[model samples]
Target: MNNAKKYNIKIAIAVALLLSAASFTFLEKQEINSKDNLMEVLYALGQDYPEHYIEKPDSANIKRGYELIHVGKTKSADGIASKAISKFYTCTSCHNVEREDLDLTLVDQDARLEYAMENKLPYLQGSTFWGIVNRESWYNDDYILKYGSLVDDAKNSLKGSIQLCATVCSQGRELEDWEMTSILSYLSTLQMKVEDLELNIAEFEQMNSLAESNPDSAIAFIKSHYLSKSPATFAELPESKEKGYSFEGRPQYGKAIYELGCQHCHHAYGESDLVLDNSVLTFRWLKKHMPDNSKKSIYEIIRKGSYSELGHKEYMPNYTLEKMSHRQVEDLRAYIESNVK
Candidate 1:
């Protein structure tokens, strides 16, 4: 029982107590139980998604930044600063967790099908979600290998990954350039939810722009990022053989990737607000729910939630798969790299 769970329990109990004498008493209690279960489920999920959820730190600053991102970084500067001070981390640093016992990711094809069929929820098409948020989240998760977690990586670079992730998760951080630089400076050291950074346009643009300014640095980033996975590296593609790897390029992949992996609740044609945040292509609803999308395609996002405008909806789905097809994912990646709109 972590403190978040404990507190949630107290909140649930308080609600139950308040509604004890109501006319729909039984229903209220049932609802309370369900809510409590949801919280517990979330706690279990946090443990499962050790990548997305942060155990509130002893440091006040750390907790504050967590809260700021929770409320959407673009929406809360004071909160982010307060939290950053204590935790001395970034949005991507503390999100990935090792315990897979309670995650709720829904990237498995079969599980996703079942989820869509059973729940009255509808997002399984191809219209929602910003490509940017998911793109960052995916990269960060994969980046885990080189940087040993986004938090540590953030400590050294301060600017590249951290700022981009913060912008997406917060739906759009409201930081001035200098503030962003400072925030980003602290963000790299974070080690929890880098996997959950939102795939928003803001974050991706920032990251891409940063990369553009320093091609050598960008290449180094990509190299380190890919190396983390220890994938078979080519003797080296002629640097000119391909255009490049980037956040913009990732969305092309993200669009198709989500179509196959997360179209269940994040459909293209729907009654819901299931659309990309002009950022990464994965659905916002799905991004926050499952940070570890092994079903993730090339340029997969490694971030989390966004602002009300970008995400603009509620309800997170769970997609879980122990394994994914590399060839299939590669196909999607190739297309995104070559022909993303």
Candidate 2:
């Protein structure tokens, strides 16, 4: 072949190789994105229903056991046995299924849910049950200080843990032997199969430190780092605002606050009978019991907390202005008013 013909062939071959490399790069990126998306969904599902994701031996007793743990009571507990108790706090109350990471003070209502569902958010103190079965010891901190190290024997440790939780946290009666066995069996299902995504603790701590001084910017930092999304991305979503409130006081926004702050104690949804306590606060109960209470009253109760007519401080902790602002209080009030039926 002539020099000119050879040069043309070389150019054609070079172009072909470049095209192949570009195609491969595109496919590889697409694959990575797909895996990331799948992982996000799986993480969200596991957080939302750790019990459903965990593997367990199939059995009638196991099924019943799972139900009992989830509900905080058995089917047999009814009538006066149920009515005498004011609340029915359960395992799920403190150990919520999903991790909540959104800084509700900054994120709008819908974006908060979207981020949570997308596995970009983290929960507060509630320990996720996803890997509880594998834990060598149960209660941490003060419980260890009080009870000594968790019992070594798996069965005994579980039983002791349940006993402490029931008698101490719930302030309720002890579980029967059968109840313990069933619940333990159910717990066994919660062993972790894969590592779960966790919030960057350092980043979270920084947000906390900044929260008192620059609450808005602190939330923006959380959105950018922990959520792996730009703060501006959330801003583009439709604004959900209430007329009288300084911040967005949409019921949805209130719902997020309630879920994080109140729902664990209040037990408004599902089988009200299964709640940890019957006397736990609910919007309807509040309206009836404290008919004279206004938004200011609610805000004060949240900020300073409440005391019984007998002068004893109530179970709730005071949410200081640092932790929750007046705007959040308004959102909570909006949520309560809308939910009262």
Candidate 3:
């Protein structure tokens, strides 16, 4: 064969091989996705009670419950009081089922409690639901156990607690009966599944890489992935008139901002700790520790974030313009000041 013909054939062969490899990779990815879907379905089916049980969950209902827990929302709103209305936050926002690699302890005390609690380490949301199925009572303090109440006594009962979370924490309307049942059914499935505890580090690595290039897209992708995993059980309801925050003044607005952002680490009013920097940032603590209690200094700290004297960035994430506006920061300052005795 001529030299040109020989080279042409070689190039063609290489191109063919490349296409074949690409096809194989695509098929492998499809197979992995199919397996993931199958596993999820099986997991849902396993949630059903045995024949001996008088009340058993339907697989479809169980799956719907999963969706409700992970992504269901009645409306969409903004700001702190409007948070409960947001579609972005759900039960999974605080009660996660997955294991992540980050040292969450640096951000929240709930994560540190894992060492003392063993398999009960907090979920990514800073609390674990492992063996939650066996717990006769819910909540960290066990309101039911201590108060001898059922799950609907308000804030104390499981149903009441769920309602409070929806209204206060999420800043949305109360969950409907079907939605509650679906969520409870899903929670009932939270057993000590050793295999599920295995962390998908690769997923996190991919997310980190994407976040570096496109943070907004990365956030959307994560939310979409979770949402797609569980189809919504109900149509989007009309937005409720309930204002998430009273907004009596700037301090209330700031409290809303604090609840939305800082509360995850600082916790409640008096629950701040040194490890999480909560103690230093609480309204009272900040007033005592900071020579200047002005809003400007507080805003600067939040905007730039706190670092150790050694120049190391603390675990607390910075609040950039992209994350919160200056007005919001001012409100946060107002909220902190209000907390002061």
- TM-score winner between 1 and 2, please give it: 2
For model 2, the run of ten residues with the poorest summed lDDT: 229-238
| Per-prediction TM-score to the true structure, in the order listed | 0.26, 0.39, 0.33
Ranking of all candidate structures by their TM-score, best first: 2, 3, 1
In the range 51-124, model 2's lDDT, one tens digit per residue, is 22222333433544555555565433232122111154556655544433344224343453445436633322
C-alpha local distance difference test of each model: 0.31, 0.43, 0.40
Model 3 stretches with alpha carbons more than 4 Å out: 1-54, 74-88, 98-126, 139-156, 192-341
How far out, in Å, is residue 11 in model 1? 10
Question: Highest TM-score, which number?
Answer: 2
Q: What is the TM-score of candidate 1? A: 0.26
- Which has the higher lDDT value, candidate number 2 or candidate number 3? 2
Candidate 2 clashes: the total is 15
| Per-residue C-alpha lDDT of model 3 across residues 1-341, encoded as one tens digit per residue | 47985576455434423322222121233112211222232223233332111134454445555555644532211221112233335565555544322332122222323332344322222234433442223333332332244334443245665665565444457776766665565554553221232327676565445545665554443433321111111111112212212233366545545554455545433222432233435457654533343322444355444322343322332343423444554555556566665
